[model samples]
Target: MRDLKPWLALIFKRPGRLVMGGALIMATLLSGIGLLAVSGWFITETALVGMLLAAGVAATINLYVPGGAIRFFAVSRTVFRYLERVYNHDTVLRLLTDIRVALFQSLASASRRHRRQLTGAEWLSRLTSDVDALDTLYLRLIAPTALAALVTALVVALTAALFDIKTATLVGLVLLVAFLIATIGTYLRTRHLAARQSDCQESLRTAVIEYIEGFAELTAAGRTGKHAAWLMRQAHQVTSEQAQADTLAGWHLAGSHLLINLSAVLTLWAGFALFRAGVVSGPVLVLLPIALLGLAEIYAMLPDAFGKLGATAASASRLNRDCQAEEPARDTGAQGLPANAALFATNLAVKHPGHAPLFTHFELEVNAGERVGILGYSGSGKSTLADVFSGLLPAAHGNLATRDLVYLTQKTVLFEDTLRANLLLGAPNASETELWRILEVVELADRFAPEPDQLDTWLGSSGSRLSGGEARRVALARVLLNPAPVVILDEPFTGLDAGTRARIAKRMDLLLEGKTVISLAHGPDALPGTDRVIHLPG
Candidate 1:
């Protein structure tokens, strides 16, 4: 539960909305109970008056006051209920927006390796399903439980005024016992099951995503049926857990219902005895039973609300574990890079967590306007070096400094947006003419020129609509648009054909003439012109 503090704080960050929502909920419940009690009294009084008139007994009874009171309660209940729903839901939506932004920022600030371990599907579940579960925490658990408490108090107070203190004490005791039984019993029975169900659901989500993403590979390997069977088995487990929770919830609801009805009956019987003894009025006797009925609106939600406790807690725990920010070690008192050098590094060391150092005591320097190639085979820390240079990964020990630079990774990642939108990421204020110039340098302008939207064409998720080579070019064009003085290309020409690679290389030389470039690749032929080649030690 301690893990939930941060998330809970976010929900209550704007206390005004929470308080207003709670006040409205209380008003809704009170109006509903008032309506039921007044209607019951009015009916009883009217019946007695009708009998008196039939018997030729003079009686004075005004229907206008009680009738008007009933109307006021009914209308207020409806109005307050509508207002409560609208305000609370609007507040919840705004709270969810804040939560999403906070979660994204936490992820962005997390260690690169940690972020890498979270697959795209896992992220989608956290951002959507986990966050959605939080809504139930406020609406179902907190609001309903708090309102139930308030309703119980009002019930006791009303009983005391209409009857004796002893009777009111008994009523309060009965309500408290019933509520505790319903809430605690439901929680103890369903908490583990709810947690298991949530886990199974996440597992099923991961399985379905894998099956879709790897459909071609699984089919080719003749393992698609096996994966599908596993997914079905997971679905069956989830359904089985859900059935157990539902069954337990049903039992709890039955028990609570019986207890409430018994309490109401006991109260009415005692009041009826008093009425027969000429100690209580007939209208007052009718009011006790109907008042308990009004309380049904509050206690009715207890079983389901407590049953959902486990699922909500599980989601909160998962989100807290994943989204908590970890501040990286800062390099204090480190000087800025000199204006004359593009990059400088000395006694550099880099390592992954719980692993031996990938590189140690590495040394490198590149003068301004120098095109350098870092040649290395796989597992030789080529990409790690790029990460270090781009400040994506911190150094274990080193003095490293560099001017602001744009990095193009080996994988070309593009969002599901327009071509123009994707390009704007590199240079937000770039003009159309500048965009066309960069595209021409990458040799993709002609391909897009014939299109209706030109640069406005929408690129599917990760640029799935484009061929591998075209995506690479689009990424390169984006890099070219960056205003940074230095650019790091990690295997920039990976997917291009030999002809296209040569053409892009020649064009890159012309376009990036005076900028410092660090091209990391397997061989020297990747970048056409290079001032020096530094081979990484394996």
Candidate 2:
């Protein structure tokens, strides 16, 4: 339960809503109990009066008050139940919005290596399914459990006041035992199964996403059937785990029902014995049994709540771990970069985990308005050096300072949005004229010339609607739009044809004029207008 403290804090951010929702839930449940008790007493008392009347005895009975109370209880229960659903769902949705934003921000700030450890599918699971699981924490676990406790207390007090300490004690003990048994037993029985099911579900999601994204490659390789079979196997595993969890939950629910019914029967039998001995009244006897019966609704939901506890806790734990920020060593003496310098590094070291240092004792200095090209083999640390320059990766053992820089990686990424929106990511306030200038420079202006929507035309996922060369051009156009002092292009022409590459290189000098540019590629010839070239050892 303590694993939920962070999420609980989010809920409490809107205290008024939380309290109001809980209050409504309490009212709804209490109204249901009141309706049941009142109906039972009214029917019993009316029958007694009828019996006396049939024996030729005059019996006075007031049906107005009890009938009115029943009506009030019924109407209030229905109204409160509806209100609770509406208000609670709205609050949950707001909480989910906050949660998604926070989760994305946290991941965005994480180290590049750490972020890479979580695959696209895993991230989707965390953001969607895991967050959805936390949604049920408040309504299912907290509210129902709290309400059950309150109901138990009220029942015990009522019984003690109307009957005796013995009866109240009996009811309290029965309820306490039943609750512990249901909660503990269900948790123990389904905890492992629930965790397995969660893992299986995540695996299935990952497999499906992979199949969708790689369908073309699979078909081309004649392995589509193999991929389909793999997906089926993952699906079967998820289904099997789900079946086991459901079976356990069903058994626990059945057991909970049996216990509640047994408690009611015992209470009724004891009440009848006391009534015959003149220790209990008919109305009180009937009320006691019916009140216990009212609790059946509360206990009925316990099995599911406890059964899901394991999965919820696992999800919470995973989120907590992923959201945790790495404590980078603070360099107290670190100073800002000089105004005239684009970037400076001295004795810099960078390495991936469990691997030899990629760069050691690396020293670099780039003045303002310099065009530098880094030529290295495939396994060389050219891209990593670019990452260090852009502050995406930290150096292990040196002082590094750089002005803000725009980076264009080898893979061009574009969201499913209008061309205008994608460009706005670089310069939010840039005018349409500015957008056209950059697009024309990147050789993409003619691509949109035939479309009526022009800049407003939607770019499909990852710019799927565009050709590979066109997507790279759009990405470069976005980078060119950024108002940064330094520009880092890492293999920007990897997928383009030779003619397209030459054309883009010839235009690079004009587009990146008066900026400190560091272009990383396989050879110095890959980037034109290179004033100097540095080659790294393999």
Candidate 3:
């Protein structure tokens, strides 16, 4: 239950919509009960009046009031049903949007290593299935449970007034037990199975995706049969859990119905004693019994909802765990940085969590408006150091400070959007001329200029439409467009031929004249123009 606190707080943010939707649901239920109770009263009165008139006695009955009420209840039931569907569905959509936005923001702030621990399929489950489980928390669990309790109390109170305290108390007890059977009992029976259902689904989804992705390799190795057998078992387990949950919910639903019907029977039997004592009229006797029976409609949805409550809590727990943000260690050197220094580092240590330090007690400083390059081979800690300097990954022990900067990571990433949109991420207000000028600097203007859509051409997923060098250049163009005081480029000239790299490197020198630059590459040929180069010991 504690796992649900954060998500519950988020859901409660839209109290106004929740209140309105609950009111509509309440009205719909009450109208349904009223319709049945009043119709019973009207029919009994009509029959009694007819008997009296036929016996050579005169009788008078008011048809207009009950008839009008029946009509009103009938119409309101339809209208409120429609309105509830429209309004509540809209609320669910808005809630989904809120949840997705918060989730993405949290993911953005989380440690990259933690996020990388999850497969792509697991992340997809969190975004789609896990989020879906939460979006309906109000409609499925909260509102129905609350409205059922309230409506039951109202019916019991009415019974007390119309019949007698003793009868109403007995009827209330029966309905209370029914409510528990539908809600608490259902949850208890299905909790373990339901809680693990999401996990099983995620496991199955990951298995299926892995199987498809590795189908060719496994087939070539003559191991596809074994992998497929494992997938079958995983899928079967998921199906078995679902079936068990459904069976439990179904039994609880039937039990609740039985108890409610028993209450109606008790009401009828007790009404007979009251009628013989001339304590209540015949029509009134039938009314209370019919109203008791009407409660079955509300309790019907409770068992299924409670059955899924365990799953919802599990989903919330997973989301909360995955999105937790760990604050990085503060850089104490920031306040003492020299005015002319673009970057300052002291006693720096670099490593991933649970791994030995890659490099420690290292120090470096770059002055403002200077070009400095750091050289290291493949196995060295060059990229790890780059991450620490850029603040993507925190250092084990370090004091570091940097002026505002833009870092072009060693990996190239571009969205499946228009080329213009991709570039705009770096500088949203960059003009067309500025864009063209940057592309020309990277010698890519000619490549895209001949395309049908020009700048608006689609980049495909991760810029799949472009070759390796072209994609690398597009990423470079974006980083260069950023107006930061310092620039960190890790293997920025990757995939470009030597001739192309020389041309771009020369052009970048003039373009970056007024900003400090820190570039990392394996050797001097791979580096751009630099005032001085630092080599790390192998």
**Candidate 3 on 1-538: residue-level lDDT in tens?**
7888877888899999999999999999999999999999999999999999999799999989999999999999999999999999999999888888888889988878778778988888888889999999989999999999999999999989999999899999999999999999999999888989978888888888878988899999999999999889888988988998999999999999999999999999999999999999999999999998899999999999999998998889999998888787857334667889989998999888888988999899899999999999896988888888887887788788888889999999999999999998899999999999999999999998999999999999999999999999999999999999899999999999999999999999999999999999999999999999999877
Native-referenced Cα lDDT, model 3: 0.92
Q: Spell out the clash pairs found in candidate 2.
A: none
Query: lDDT per prediction?
Result: 0.85, 0.84, 0.92
Cα-based lDDT at residue 189, candidate 3: 93
Q: Per-residue alpha-carbon lDDT of model 1 for 1-538, expressed as tens digits?
A: 5756778888878789888998999999999988999999999999999999999999878889999999999999999999999999998888888888888888777768677667888878888899998855677777888888888888888877877687778888888888886788899989989988887798789779979999999999999999899888889888888888988988888877776777688788778777888878999998987888788778888898888778878888888877766665534112556658888888889988788999899888788899999999989999998988887777888878877789998778898998999999899999999999999988989988998999999889999989998998899899989989899999999788888899889988988889999999988877667889999887
The TM-score obtained by model 1 is: 0.77
Q: What stretches of model 2 exceed 4 Å from their correct place?
A: 1-3, 204-243, 273-281, 328-342, 349-360, 367-382, 394-399, 403-406, 417-460, 463-538
- Give the clashing pairs for model 3: none
Ranking by TM-score: 3, 1, 2
Poorest 10 consecutive residues by lDDT, candidate 3: 328-337
Off by over 4 Å in 1: 118-121, 211-233, 269-280, 327-344, 349-358, 365-381, 394-407, 417-460, 463-538
- Candidate 1 accuracy as lDDT: 0.85
Screening candidate 1 with a backbone cut-off below 3 angstroms (N, C-alpha, C), the clashing residue pairs are none
